[model samples]
Target: MPWDLRDGEPVIDPAQVRALLREQHPDLAHMPLGEPVRGWDNTMVRLGERLALRLPRHAQAETLLDREAAWLPRLASQLAGLPSGTPHHAIPAIPTPVRTGVPRTGYPFRWAVVPWVEGTPAVHVPLEVRDAYAPNLAATLRGLHQPAPEDAPASAFRGIGLADIEDRFARRWDALAGGLGRERRDQLAEVWRRAVNAAPYAGPRVWLHGDPHPNNTVLAGVGPGPMASSPVLVDFGDLCAGDPASDLGSALLHFSPYGREAFMAAYDAGQVPDPALWARAQGWAVNYALIFAAQSPGEALRPLGRGLLA
Candidate 1:
């Protein structure tokens, strides 16, 4: 039986996914399906060994996968086709959909099957000593921020002008103030103002990962040093074209004190950031910190919000 979406929560299971696959893609339906991994937008399940299925769990989340499916393949191909002499960073493998699924049976949302990537979510691992991963992260961002096509999807919040979202930022900060303590709150306010006042990005729009938090970045084998590991970025639902600062801000949200510095150093080695860009990035970081902190105190992301300021 098709599971219902009760109380706005999507009910999905391995059996439902397998049934859907059998109806639409019968050839591989017999293969074992993995347990569901619930996320903010979709429920992911491993298909066989090398593939994974992603089904939308919310109405808004349904709109993003098509965009991801359409653009990511081209982007991945372009990066792979780069000439040997072209200045590009070592971009970790990005998951690209091999097949796009249509609405069938009781499942109403569009879905996709993509190659599975191997790694542990960065949030579950210790971040304090993974300073070495910062440069790699920076390089990945530098490569991703290349100018996107004119027809690329426009984001209401992701890549738009920072000044446009000032009101939203204020509300989030207001909710976060008391929990953050006076000193930290005051420090955060200053950071926000500096970012809002900084000169805006005047360059052509570039593609962005939209959300680059620790949970989105996956870490592979441990390196020689303690807490060191290879990093792989996942989730392109928030992918859009915009200011590089939007993604840079995530470094603040994900990395520790020294790791943040190392990320900037590595990024600067490839493309030096202007003072204004740095300021704007800091502002973006503040925005994320406030929002995460403002969530219900018991929310899991509250710690991440605290760490952004720390």
Candidate 2:
């Protein structure tokens, strides 16, 4: 059931919103409310109305989502083909009014009311299904890295790179005992440094859905063209423009060698990436997995974390 937006007590609890859905959009509200999708970084609620509400679980998310809104359009030319959670002008950062009886001034964290793309998040699909899946995902990634014009519009965000990321992990590790043993951590750190050195690509810059997790991927009924039947990418809050490999967290960390081959074959069928950069992508995938771990305590992201570490 859809949320019946009407005048009433300020909706304070998320449960209250669910209640409104039941009272209003019975067809949707009653179907089944999946457990609230939780991420240490954010909270998500799936609306029965073919949409999802993304509530930034923290203040940092406000900046990230805002950046996404600003940057995605620059890559619209290529993203139109891949649309995996690409930021849309139609979606608004609608704050769920914090209903405090008399009506409080604002809602909880910065939030966005997003369109929910149908299909499952790619968390635990079998290896067999992956053969078909990886290519689609690769095609989407290809579209993301498509060459852009020299004079084309670009993203305004000028923020941290792999170094800022390294610092984050270093500091986070320092907060713990032993700090990820010298030898192994050093290897990871060296890789991180290499990725940093290899930053700022000279290749044509294009927008990427900075965080394209299995959860963020959703299969839309086949659309059109070579890439049409694949899962449509969704979740654009982390979108950015840069070396496309920055988004290959899955290929390097999650996909098997065979899976990687299939994905790469599809992604690089006609175009090839700088070999040096592709190596850097391996490091990015590892770091991305680690960085992503700090965002949530879910069994879903665990195997990917283990794979990256391995």
Candidate 3:
């Protein structure tokens, strides 16, 4: 497990989940429930070969789970409308829930049965291999960054101005200053300053993945040739609508310098380049880097945070 349950949060076991499925979704009760994999907000257990059950581990994740259940299907439909044989078509799949479960006497949050996407987490894949898929990643973002509806879900921590969360950033920075040392902290401060000073986004709010870090992406074989191992975006817990720069900043987490160039070239092909947007994107990268380092300490993403800062 990569995360711990917060104090007072209940622990859900296989027996309880199985009982819930038997009561609410009998058809799925017979399937084997694999070991649970705990993420920041949810716990996932593989249900047989083709499906997985996603349940919130705590009350705070309940709303996020609801939002994903509401929006992923709609996003999938929009992506499906794209012409075949294009880069958009190359995006293998989104983890749309096939079935949903409601809160019960013991289980207090909603759960969903989503298609089990087969692939390797992008974090485990070498940067060179990830570089090969940068164009596909770019195209996926282009298709996904459509203007969102007026009532779409919004995020306080993402897709908003960096200044809005400046206080939060400062707290995390200061807390980690001793461990990160003066040199690293000073470098990160400069990135944050530039991001806050950059021109605010004047464009419409766009659909954002909200948290598109490498771990949230999966590299699955989609088609033949170079496009075989396409990147599949997953974990819609933080899905929301806000500045496109919020998602664009993830390019720093997903690519090497050469790969980033390829991604930008592919992403900015037709539209006029926005220097402010790119600066803000870098700022978002800084934000995520700090988050990863602060939240996980000496874990896998710590090195990644250092890379992003570099």
Candidate 4:
């Protein structure tokens, strides 16, 4: 139950992180450890200017960190050689792990030192200005959807067919129905049912970022107007191989109708998706919204949850 809702997970401050570094990685221990960037799963401490130390705040995040350590290097190597006209080639950049650390002293889980990627999280970007970055986001997803190696991690509930998680979705949908408008609730129900019945992805398994929400995507320079900007995709904790539709949830959850259209347009420009894929993406959106509502309802992600249901 790593994903289970809990407020009592152990905390790792700069002092504790410094201690771990001093004991296990003294070369990095001398570098300044900046304030920690707190997230639901991990607390990332900026280690000097170029690297970040990511430590799990919750038990479940350990497995995800290990997944990233095992898979990202292989994925990064393939990204450069992907087809030229494909979205993978269009991605701005991705984080590279400098070193992976094992449990030591006060820290009881695996951790990593990754290159600190630049850009603003889509959540921090204003709604009025988000349309400009949609296409870049689409390209990042398209790039990440390349076929994974045979031994890539399997995320049972993440990148799998929507039908596989339908029951879990139904329960969360029931819980969320209480606070939503009847119209919105009805719309969500219809969207979920249609997606559940739609033809599942019949293509070969491709890499999925697992969680492609706004916070995970970092935009470098999001200038104004309709001008597009390439965004760097980060936080590969949920990396797995499965339906590409599962990874497209961020476009709907983070953008306006216009932005959603722009994203699909950019994605189709490279490789057109089956129309049915939209239905499955919508279902994955529901899954994301409901999970946030159930686990951390007051979180910033809840705003996107409402948008997804809307």
Global Cα lDDT for candidate 3: 0.81
lDDT of 1 by residue, 134-235 (tens): 877887887777788898777887877788999898777676676766887788788888888889999998888888877788776554352354667788
Give each model's whole-structure lDDT. 0.78, 0.54, 0.81, 0.77
Task: Rank the models by TM-score, top first.
Answer: 1, 4, 3, 2
Better of 1 and 2 by TM-score: 1
lDDT, candidate 3, 124-173, per-residue tens: 76778878888888887887887787988999888999889888878877
Predicted model with the maximum lDDT: 3
Q: Report the lDDT tens digits of candidate 2 across residue range 199-279.
A: 455665665666676666665443233223456666666655566666774454446768777776666665554665665
Predicted structure with the largest TM-score when compared to the true one:
1
Error of 4 at 226 (Å): 12
For all predicted structures, in order, the TM-scores are 0.92, 0.63, 0.88, 0.89
Report the C-alpha lDDT of model 4 over 1-310, residue by residue, as the tens digit. Answer: 1344357766678888988898888999999888987787888899998889998877788888888888788888888777676434564365767798888876778889988876678777787566777877877777778888788778778778877887887788788788888998888888888888988888888888888787786766546532246556788888899888888865567788788888778777746667788888888877887876565545667677766665
Give the lDDT ranking, best first: 3, 1, 4, 2
The pairs that clash in candidate 4 are: 88-143
Error of 2 at 181 (Å): 12
Show the lowest summed lDDT stretch of 10 residues, model 1.
1-10
Q: Which sections of candidate 1 miss by over 4 Å?
A: 1-6, 222-229, 296-300
Better of 1 and 2 by lDDT: 1
Cand. 4 TM to true fold: 0.89
- Alpha-carbon lDDT of model 1: 0.78
